[model samples]
Target: MADATVRPESRWYGPLAATPRHLFVPRWWSPGERDGTWVYELRDGASDPDAWMSCAYDKSLSVITRVGPHHADHAASAAVVPEAWPTSSATLPALVVKLYQHAFLADDSRLLVTCGSGYGTALACRRLGDGRVTSVDVDPYLIQSARDRLAAAGHRPQLEICDVTGALPGVYDRIVSTVSVQGIPASWLAALAPGGRMVTALSGTGLLIVADKTADGGATGQVAPEPAAFMGTRHGDDYPPAPDHADLWATARKADGESVTTGRYPVMRVNSTWDVRSTLELTVPGIEHRMESGADGTRTAYMLHPDGSWARATAPGARQVPTVHQGGPRRLWDELDRIRTWLVIDGDLPVAGAAVRIDPDGTCHLSRSGWSASIGAQ
Candidate 1:
């Protein structure tokens, strides 16, 4: 499956085909729906070799290795964890190839890439040679485990336990990250050798930022047309617990708000649409989304922001208009509708293929069709 997904002419094809993905992830978290909640079912390779082989080689499937701090290997056989967020995974093969393609590596380019399952790092070593590949991860265990697996695969590359957003270990011609970041880390700009390139996704959005280092410790490029949403980078073994939003959730779920009106469109889950979701996220970051469908063919969508704003919309069925309720200081639904309106009128959102300019302080300016927005660095 991996060989078919990676084009034969590409440099990464050979490496991706040669590496054994199952070796790096002998046990992984496989998500399944149980009742109304999501659960992680651990899949051990030794127990189910056929199922393991099928999953390991699937081109588009990412096998989750850790949920918060609970590693799949540490769990008892047949364990099922409910409502736990995945913290780490072996990234899908095609996406890894997409990132490498965006980097535009040359034969002599020294590369620094993120290490997740060690599969990507192995591919890099196979394509670019072990001496030129350097991989880093925030978790020491991940780094150590990747090093051992990579060695077992007959490749020894530099592996370090370092936060990708912090100061890097050495200079390199390219730095690619599978994890997303809220902003362009200043350290990346500083560590990139002159004229180097980077490919990374913006946090909370499906924007694939591709940029090249400049003389003044900044970068200039544009967002790719393709959208990608990688897991956000973490500073510790597990992400710091999410903040309590019970009060806000309760209001959004049931309470009548300060404003009520007929919505312009039907109740839609913004997260399910890449273009609309990306535009909305860029317009208003940090909005949690939830959607539920009733047995009577009614659909309801809720949007909650950290700033005490909440919005809920409901529609009786497909193609039916929705009624919206909003509360708090800001009208969260209005912002989302405004972005959607822009898309409807202009035929597309500026976020797709927008020009990106990163300043020395890590402030990213995105502009397209006379519209511009800034992210990060205040």
Candidate 2:
């Protein structure tokens, strides 16, 4: 995992190699389908040592530690939790390194990072010493478990049970979050030392922001050239149930829209494409997407927003244009087509390398090529 995650001479190499990731994650959840319904199948490392080593060291795989409110360690033998969001995980090593790399840590830089299974915090401790690293998580269980595990691994960093968006424990020169946030939290601005850097991804988008604290108690940076995403931070056991979209789904699936037209682009799985998804998320905030492909070569895509807007588009095949139907106060499909058109003409979306200016109040302003969007406190 170390070799796959970082170069031998990289500053993170020694720390990554020295830390035992498997210790941080003794039990994890794996997704599987049971009787046609999604479920999280528990996997105990002690029960299967070989599989444990393989999975724990896999550079690209994130070991889910807690699913909704069901923690794998406390689950019954061969437990399977009904499908729900993952609450915590030992994030993929490569991605963790990427977040660290974005921070540009100095030799003595005080580091504050989001802790889940504590693997990332261990790596930070190994690299910068336990005294220089502080990790926070909202789950009290996670904090206690991680603290015990870190001590067993011969490292003890300050582990706090606190929401990342709330008051932080101390000022730090480098702040990095494995969990995504909707916007730069004002508390983060207040906790960062002058000229400190922050690296985090926006929730629901693949845009990573790397900002340096400014004199005005805000931040200035840019959307990373490469896209990355992480689960959003939660204050409680699980995220508030995803917005109820049952009625909107029905409207998108069955209702003929107020306007119908042949779409200029093929039906796109907007949720799957990072660049396109990021751009649309910036422009149309709370939209949800669903897609299906018929066995007979027909593809259909649906878009629904909390504002009572819905769009359905159907195409004969992957490369064919789609017939679009949109209903509501706004034309959802047209907005998607417009963004696709911009991509076709510009060869890239503006969100990729957009300039990010965050206000002291946590209002994030993103702009590039005359396109600008603001994400304020929710």
- Give a tens-digit lDDT track for model 1, residues 1-378: 655886687677788789998898999998898897789888899999998999999989888998888888788999989767688889988988889999998998899999988999998998899999999999888888888899999999999999999999999999999999999999999889999999999988999999998898899999998999889999998888776889999999898899999889777778888878887877788899989899999999999999999999999997798899999998999988888788889999998889999998889999999988899842
If scored against the real structure, what TM-score would every candidate get?
A: 0.97, 0.98
Which lDDT tens digits does candidate 2 get at residues 61-87?
999999999998899999998999898
Against the reference, the lDDT scores of all candidates come to: 0.89, 0.92
lDDT at residue 274 of model 2 (Cα atoms): 90
lDDT of 1: 0.89
For model 1, name the residue pairs that clash. none
Query: Tell me, what's the RMSD of every candidate?
Result: 1.2, 1.1
Q: What total of clashing residue pairs does each candidate reach?
A: 0, 0
